[model samples]
Target chain A: MHTDLVAALDIGGTKIAGALVDGHGRILLRAQRATPAQEDGDTVMRAVEDVLGELTVSPLWSGARAVGIGSAGPVDASAGTVSPVNVPGWRGYPLVEGVRRATGGLPVELIGDGVAITAAEHWQGAARGHDNALCMVVSTGVGGGLVLNGQLHPGPTGNAGHIGHISVDLDGDACPCGSRGCVERIASGPNIARRALDAGWRPGPDGDTTAAAVGEAARAGDPVAVASFERAAQALAAGIAATATLVEIDIAVIGGGVAKAGEVLFAPLRRALADYATLSFVQRLTVAPALMGTDAGLVGAAAAALTRRNSATAAGV
Target chain B: MHTDLVAALDIGGTKIAGALVDGHGRILLRAQRATPAQEDGDTVMRAVEDVLGELTVSPLWSGARAVGIGSAGPVDASAGTVSPVNVPGWRGYPLVEGVRRATGGLPVELIGDGVAITAAEHWQGAARGHDNALCMVVSTGVGGGLVLNGQLHPGPTGNAGHIGHISVDLDGDACPCGSRGCVERIASGPNIARRALDAGWRPGPDGDTTAAAVGEAARAGDPVAVASFERAAQALAAGIAATATLVEIDIAVIGGGVAKAGEVLFAPLRRALADYATLSFVQRLTVAPALMGTDAGLVGAAAAALTRRNSATAAGV
Candidate 1:
């Protein structure tokens, strides 16, 4: 009557989250700690351990078979290390080894956060029934992952489907990542707000000048605000179309802060997609909002662990 | 000992070529016929049958175990049909069925010509040791194929790596493929010549106005010619970078006429790649000229047939 479970962790600059997830992806226990991102490597490790410490104490811990970590990248899944840009202290940090030790040498799997989200969507969200798909997050930065031939394709470095940084405009403005006119440069939340501000769209009485505010203004019929969102949509469409052309995906699932703007983003995005996704095979590609919400990373990490265990068992390894 | 061989057919607008290939990839025998491209579908198919008939009459015919067809696309490997743009008479033609019948009901496998070339590259050419790669042909048109996880990824319809039609410059000139600023629209051999001519670079007195002549002019220090090649390289860089970013390829193997321009095309391609492929995982991507010669399609088709037969045997199907 006992059910198998996996321990899952979602590590990002802002926080470290841990959960005990069952076979059906139900979270049985949860714990979290704010990331000491600005501190030294050891301090950040302490935060991750604190989150794991709480999970280990639960009576349900003994049922867990493995641990999965979905961390902000570039993570070296091959080398079991991470060097997140925002968390300078964690450069080349031995995250997998650290987590493995804390959990009594349980097997560990690590992937980029974007890939983890894609796994979650492919498992039980907008991309559930699709065999080939691209799932994306359009928050402060645009990050993404691919599901190819019905399996999550976390490339050798665990960073396939990093769509945000792909150049859509070869001669456009320079991005912080040392590229020009990347999708993230034009479609990320910050970029949307910045473009609107640069085009003379001012904040309201509350003085909030976020991308969300720009979305609101566009919904209220502000031409400059509308123009900024339209531009972001164009970049996203170009990137998405390029992905489909390369890998033959049938659907693109989008999430994160910018995607929450709903029709304000989706309408322009769909229209622009028609212009770029003109190939017969890609002409039928559909874009949909992601359904997993905030728990996607944790759930996806759990999915990765479960799938790995199943595959190994099936192979009699 | 009787060695098992595979019959491979490379069907194009101008020719229908057949080969009997050994396990070691050597072409043991060959046959070819001029394609009746402008004739009715039945007539074009008759040319293909004639090439196969010659192969069948060979004393070594009894050694052939399977057949593979690499034809101009878009081909539906699943539906066993083909609709190549250049062969207007073959729209939705039952190509696989016809070949199957022609070869005495031998098991047949079909793939697009681009995918076939990629199979050759992965099996024995420039892409040979790389696990994930993109192989492209930049001739009168741009076409390509992908190898992911060390296997040829001929997507559902056998056209996963059709990179030519993906828009790189969203606002640039329209392409015949219904997309704007496709890699082919700017980087194909004909486009390279057209761009150079439009920029006021005239051909030599020999009146040979091909992209090769333009390459010679650029090597001789014609600024306009160099600029046109540079522009083509820029667009190619964008498309190649996009492929690597989306799929995490470590190498891109380029073939065909434009790739033959040597450093005049490569110098700019490598430099422009630096501008677009800025991500840590993709920054190390290497560009190499394809090593496979004109027989790539036939050799690749043979490779596909051999691989398919091996896979089927291993599965005990």
Candidate 2:
């Protein structure tokens, strides 16, 4: 049985991204649709169908044999349902069944969006051929995936590497995930801006309030912006240290928008990690940007489909 | 090619423990000796040799084939040397060589004491057959080891699961490792007592206090003791929650005499873990007691030696 083309979709609270990727780990065609913010499960399902329709009819996916979906938090892969916290009306929705129906039963698979990114990066991105790697998306929010022993750890419900909530400080800011001082609450884009704003640091007479602006200001030597970035970097470094200390990772490939702050963030991160001197095993941590960019989600989603590409060809479902 | 008898030595800050362990994970003979606090390198080596001499001549080590040494921090396994912080006289000491000469050149292996304990638990104790586990000794200090994908994770120097130094609270106590708010300084045996003493609770009429006596008081309904255990539990829960969220550990087997507090500690731990409701991945955290007790170090040392046993046989070195 030959399998080449596969449909991939990345589901988030803000947007839903879809693509047609072939066996070569290349996205042949792509499309995006805004998440129907307050829409019910059926409405989101329709969005998925519309996106897939754009791909299946395109020349790229005309020969595609299977589909894969990567979604936000707390996915039950075995049951093919998702209970994403950010997206309303998405409690225990049968996500795989919806995609299967959209593709006319072309064998769809589901995985946590973070897990998908990890698998994609492991298979084709910077961390390829490395058995133990931590894939993190430091974007609008932090998300992660674990590749240990050359296989992905999906945990009890495919939520193994939700490292955004890993505590950097117990007395830290309260995270949306009902925890305090999670890395997300301190380092995510919005959090960076929030911290700077809370610190009463204004970039100029006119405030362009946001993490992107904070990054720009920090680059331009805005004290508050710089401090916020340092704080986030320190927290990120601590978490990275703990991760390295525990997992003994060879390299930490950091993706996501906030990473764009670049050296302003990495310098402090390196310093804080150095302060974790007592741990000798993982002190030799190598930090790098993820090779894959915006399309990591789509690529990761596609990798998940390809892993089961054979099943799509076998039962001819 | 048969392997059975081996000498196991545990080097701690206050004392040095040695034992003769058989193939069945049983200690055939054992002894504990005081560590020479102000001794030089040669002096400590002589002390180690004296202990080895007793083990080899005993009934247990009459047929011993090798030696396993589990020592305090900062070890270079490849170089067969140790830089123990507790044994200041032994900086860059050739521990493997010392034990070899003492045992008359029988094969010798050395590992981080924490790693040895972790391996011991996995091989014959609480973490049996479980490929993923973390064993923590929450005594006067907290130290740990990770077993992921069925292999012990000893960071570059075999000190991987050093959770004691992992920062939990930014405002928490300053750890001896130079980190601020480490779990060790917040929840460890002595920390529990110290925090309680500061809270105006006399552990006893005379303050020759220890974590064990505190546990006894709590068991006997001393409110101060109960509160101290709760604080420690809360801190541990936060730390454990962060770890569970990051690594997706299947079980956390806590050892050390401090864990004898039992429900006094675990109850608050479960409550604090529930506060992380935003994180769906770590909800099913299970806290269990360590099974090997004080023998953990000896058994772990033995298991660590056995890992080298196969390699030694294969290399014919």
Candidate 3:
């Protein structure tokens, strides 16, 4: 039979999105609901079911042989549970079983959101054709994932490439995650905005004090605003260089809101990378912008489901 | 045919040791030579040839099915060449080709010294049952390798886990490798001794100025000596935590001279690890001493050869 479709779910603090994705990565049907992030566990589960309800009612639902979930982490693929830092309502929640029952007992695969984005990048974006790569999202938090030896390395608990929390500055500031000098502590978009505002860079008529505003001020030749991005770039370069040095990745793909700052982040990032990645094997590493858009999470989840199905078929399971 | 033996070579800056190892990782025959490290390329080649010559004459040589060489960095297994920093006479030297010819064209594998030790540790030491681990040698230089997904992750160039060169303090002291504040720069034995001496810690009547003496002083309650080890421990902790956060290893196995300091180094390391490895996935990570002694490289090389031979046999090649 031509069971080539996969059901994908992208669960986050802000939204719960579901889609029926075909083998060519096209979304044939879609549904989404605002996450009841502050509600109780069953309330959040109800929102997830609502999205899945829409998906299952679609004419294309029967073609989906498997289901994949990309949830905000930390996820325990081994336990088929997730306890995303933002989703306190669902601590160690049985997401796989919930989704399995919602989809008529379809085989389910769960991975961290960062890993799902990496799968998308490896399959059809900036990291395409690269055997070893790092794909990052530098937005509210600096999350990332790895592609090692031409395959997605989701790690034992599906959180292998959690680069945001890795300490680059051992004696620097303390992170809310209880670690000091984490990359997310220094380089995330919120940190960038905070550093800029702390340095006396103010918002214009719009009264918007976001990182995007700082990016605008930096592009318009504001020294303090530029310096904040430079500092963030430095932290990112150190973290990226550390990853390359430890794992030998040939490319790094950057995406998300902060990455939209363009050369303000990239120019300094590239220059600082040269300063840190000095070893023979890692010196040749390159950085690029991510091509996958907002649909990356859903598409990547579908890719994961497709890969699992293919592997199980190959194993005659 | 039993095919119960493999020829193993552990090439380093100070010595070239060779052995014929049985299938159970026992060394039944051995050869050794002082490395002509400062001589021309041909002289060094001659020393290696002489070591191989002794192994070739052993009565059990005919039973060897493959050969493995574990040499100092930076090695390029893809190109079959090596350019160890201490051995400047052999820049991109064709070690693999030469060893292949010396062994009468026996299938050969080459890996960095750190990777070789990791293979040994995974086979029969501290990391034996762990599917993912980082094995480190903290001596004059800090070197390490990774075992991921129950296999040695040598990377494309056989140098994936060169952790010493990754910078933890991006703006701190400059490293000789053209990076700033690398783990090796801050945590190596030489640096530990230098920091202790610079802080006015005096040697005993024996005038022993090594890290071992520093360890002795720290054990004897010298504040200066303890502070120096604490600083080294901090750098190591940051580096190790960074590794765990990026790749998700469950344990870190430490060996070599400085690791011999016991609680003086490990106590501070474990404490500092709690400060950096705070993420949920990495919080459970443990540190242990490597069990393989001085014969790690040779035995690990033998393990690599055996694994390769067994894989080839399975492939019917």
Maximum-lDDT candidate: 3
* Best-fitting candidate, scored by TM-score: 3
TM-score of each: 0.98, 0.84, 0.98
Give the higher-DockQ candidate: 2 or 3: 3
lDDT of 1 by residue, B1-317 (tens): 34669999999988899999988889999999998889999999999989999999988989998998898888888788998888999988999999989999989989889999999999999999999999999999999999999899988778789989888787889999877888999999999999889889998899988999999999999999999999999999999999998888999999998899999999999999998888888898999999999999999999999999999998997
TM-score of the second chain of model 1 compared to its true counterpart: 0.98
lDDT of 2 at A147: 77
If you assessed candidate 1 against the hidden native complex, which CAPRI class would it receive? medium
lDDT of 3: 0.93
Worst 10 residues of 2 chain A by lDDT: A276-285
DockQ of each: 0.77, 0.42, 0.84
Considering summed lDDT, which 10 consecutive residues are worst modelled in model 2 chain B? B276-285
Off by over 4 Å in 1: A1-3, B1-3
lDDT for each of the candidates?
0.92, 0.79, 0.93
Which 10-residue window of candidate 3 chain A scores lowest in summed lDDT? A1-10
Local accuracy of candidate 2 as per-residue lDDT tens digits, B187-222? 888888887788776756766588887887888888
